[model samples]
Target: MSKLLNDDVKEMLTNILKDMVDEVYVKVYVDTLTCETCTETHQLMDEISELSDKIHYDLVETHGDKTVGDKYGITMYPTMVVLDKNQEDKGIRFNGIPAGHEINSLLAALVDMSGKPLDLDDATIEAIKAIDTETNIKVFITLSCPHCPGAVTKAHRIAMLNPYVKAEMVEAQTFHEFSAKYNVSSVPKIVINDTHDFVGNQPMEVFLDTIREAA
Candidate 1:
């Protein structure tokens, strides 16, 4: 297959990744037998990693023991889990090929996970860190959706701040059955803990309200 990123795009990403202060790792889980987008997902990781010395990825196959996938709570193929500079899981994931506008979220995640502090107030950061309850945030989106990246970026930022919270970007089209379970009729549907859900690229406070309720 041809390269997913062309020369100009690669140049832009190279500059953006230069802001990374520390190394970041993305573990991509795949099952060749069952995953249709697994190949493209792996290729995308490769292309992104090539743009920066601070970025890397390990291709993990979920065909046998499933230990790695279990460790990361990855039950789906073509899932990319972003780890911090210390190679620790940051509860940030993309459960499909992050092409189109979703690519912005993936890039932002890599930069944010690399020892950079989130641009949030101290009180807001403390609030996120203090949430002791287990929180799961799933942002259902299609690759083409223009507004999806904003929602995904916000969810992932919260996840990066608190280990108790897990955030994932689920490509609705790729995971149609799972999307149906949430009745994801619109793009950028935000689901918290599988019970409280709302649609749109809502503000940070709105997201926190739903998360607080879930907590």
Candidate 2:
């Protein structure tokens, strides 16, 4: 089969990952029997791992490795769990194929897992650090959406900063049931704790305030 990422893309990834200070392991959970994109997602992650020593990946079959899947709360195929250098799962999840603009979100996740600080304002970071209540954030997105990455990155950063936050980037097309349930007609729909939700990309301060209010 052909490579998932081209030479230029590989080179770009290499450069971006070269500054990584810690190791990042991407654990991909897949159910080969039901997932059409499992092979492609595996191949893509494998090629990405080759770009940097700091990056590595493991493919876990959902049925065959139920314990591991269960440990990560992976109920869907093509779910990526980004672990920090110590192999700690901070609840950074990606449900569905990370292609197109979502690829940028994938890269940002790697950077975050590598212990690199997010580029948010100091005040924003402090506010996130102050969040003591558990917050589960799901940002529904489609691969083709140009504006999806920004929202995904922000949510992931929030998860990285606060231990109370668990963020997921859900591909709406792959998980149609969730899209229907949440009424996600548009992309980048932010769902917080299944109680509060909103559509479109929100500013960092506004997003933080929203979570605080929901909590």
Clashing pairs in 1: none
Worst ten in a row by lDDT for model 2: 61-70
> Poorest 10 consecutive residues of model 1 by lDDT?
61-70
TM, every model = 0.96, 0.95
In lDDT terms, how accurate is model 2?
0.88
Q: Point out where model 1 deviates above 4 Å.
A: 64-68
Question: 1-215 in candidate 2: lDDT tens per residue?
Answer: 99988999898988988778899988988888888888888888899899888998888877655566878788878899999999998889999998999999998899878978778788888998999999999999999999999899899888888889999999999999878999999989999988898888888877788898899
